[model samples]
Target: MSRIPDLPGVISSDEIVASAEHLAGLQTDSGMIPWWPGGHCDAWNHVESAMALDVAGLHREAERAYEWLADIQRPDGSWHNYYLPDGDRDMAVEDDKVDTNVVAYIATGVWHHWKCTSDRSFVDNLWPTVERALDHVLSLRKDDGLVLWAVEADGTRRWDYALLTGSSSIQHALRCGAAVGLATGSPRPDWVDAADRMCSLIANEPLAFQPKTRWAMDWYYPVLTGAIEGEAAKIRLADGWPTFSMEGLGIRCVSDEPWITASETAEASLAYASIGEFATATDLLRWTRSHRCPDGSYLTGLVYPDKVVFPEGETSSYTAAAVVLAADAIAGASPGSDLFVRSSLRPS
Candidate 1:
């Protein structure tokens, strides 16, 4: 039987499967999972959805989603920031940008799928794609080891600053990439070294990246990515709790905003679980139920005082995906469950 995450009283295996089904229902015929029925797709969130599908035992659908990425990958191994459901570039101002974190995420998805299935042939097939993607990401790293946030569609002009959340995510991807390399007998020590440097920067040099302290992702991503762990991870979450968390309603998207997003809450839960704080993680995850829809989809955000959906009828595949991933992390039933919890995937 395919392993499915079951979080006991918090969430049943069947409910998690239903959530994946809801997300899968939003996927295009070409295997592209959009934010919603008519929404745009981004490489990062698309990979996130694919990971969730794997967690729910939707292996065929998950593999198909990865194939969609392989089909659309740009020559430079990066994808545009956004694509329409029909597989055309969105071409909006920032939509055409190539985000390093976005490109690096394929390694995470591929590594997670490999863990879920132990499919060495599948890893071999996708190895080149992950290699090219991370290679392109490493090429963009600055002298300080932090990567630039993004580049123009031409892949020539680049952003001057890096983002804490984005770079932290890239670090996690690098570790996942190294794990994939090791499994395929292609051992990428360089990728592992780069990931360690990035982790050091994230742990000690907060000023290395652009300050988006107001954003919930910036507050939790270091822990979520395992860039910060042990007592340090606990301290970080506690420090940000008052600012970003909203008691029973989930966490705010931005520190000052009354709007709470399910995605952020779910991911923060994973961060807590990574540090052995399962009770706290479960509480944060239980809060996400406030935004859950009847059909197993999650609302993007709910504005407090009114409890209105901020995007106005928005339920994103990524938000639901986050919930699935968090449940898996807590349940510890899938092979990929430790992908986020572990500080490193490298062989000891």
Candidate 2:
């Protein structure tokens, strides 16, 4: 028998529809899912929100997003980190190509959605985009299995730093890709090995440099991305409950201070469930609900008064993805059931 979903209360169909409707408004005709109604576009947020739409049974919106990504993909298969409402590039790295290593790895989610609905056309249309993106990213892999943060077409430093987050996400994308290859009878060993190396590296050694930030994503993403597994993964979860986690609003981006944000919080909460911590996952999901906005958008951060930063009022596609992803975890959709993370672990 299928397990019953334990969603927050009896959220009316109307409420879910309203939330979905608000999400629909965020979608531009160009197919990009902006953060707020008129906020900047980001690759990370795009894939994250697409995954959310997939889980919600909104395949068309999600497909549109992938198409948007494909249309804007650089010749080398990379994308800038950000863009404007007019589709004009903004805040791009020096190379104008993004290191979106974490962002590009969302193929796992895409393939997972494909498996659920048996949508061959979605797979056919997106296969090329996924392939090219992976090909570009795989070129960045280092001998140690860690990818350079970002390299320009001319080969210059973008992020110029190795991030544990990037490695973990790549690992996830590779795994998801491998799953797709197997299902589609197109298994690629190179991709799987690359993902394996990334996971092995992170598990054996700490690669993420921002240790000072009290962000919980650093603590849990390793496992969530499949870098650590079995007893080790479980142990990491037990050890990290206090190390990087904040009590209420969710995990901070790092351990440096008290900086809490919705996306990271949701990501961390989902991470908890990734390792089978249902109790904590349930709590974090509840906390996230309290922050839900009237129009179904979510708050970005809580680093107020002390952090002299304008609280961006717009809710983001990534933020929405984080929220829905966390809810899916609470509803028993975990890494075991996660296809997005799996395909993300695959090669192009």
lDDT by residue (170-255, candidate 1, tens digit) is 98899899999999999999998998999999999988988899999998899888888778988999999999988888889998
In candidate 1 the C-alpha lDDT for residue 182 amounts to 92
The collision pairs in model 1 are none
Return the top candidate by TM-score.
1
TM-scores across all candidates? 0.95, 0.85
Model 2 regions more than 4 Å off: 1-6, 10-17, 87-95, 100-103, 157-160, 207-214, 303-314, 333-337, 340-348
- Point to the candidate with the largest lDDT: 1
Q: How accurate locally is residue 98 in candidate 2, as Cα lDDT from 0 to 100?
A: 62
Q: How much is the lDDT of residue 260 in candidate 1?
A: 93
* Model 2 residue 233 lDDT score: 78
Q: What's model 2's lDDT at 146?
A: 75
What is the alpha-carbon RMSD of candidate 2 to the true structure? 5.0
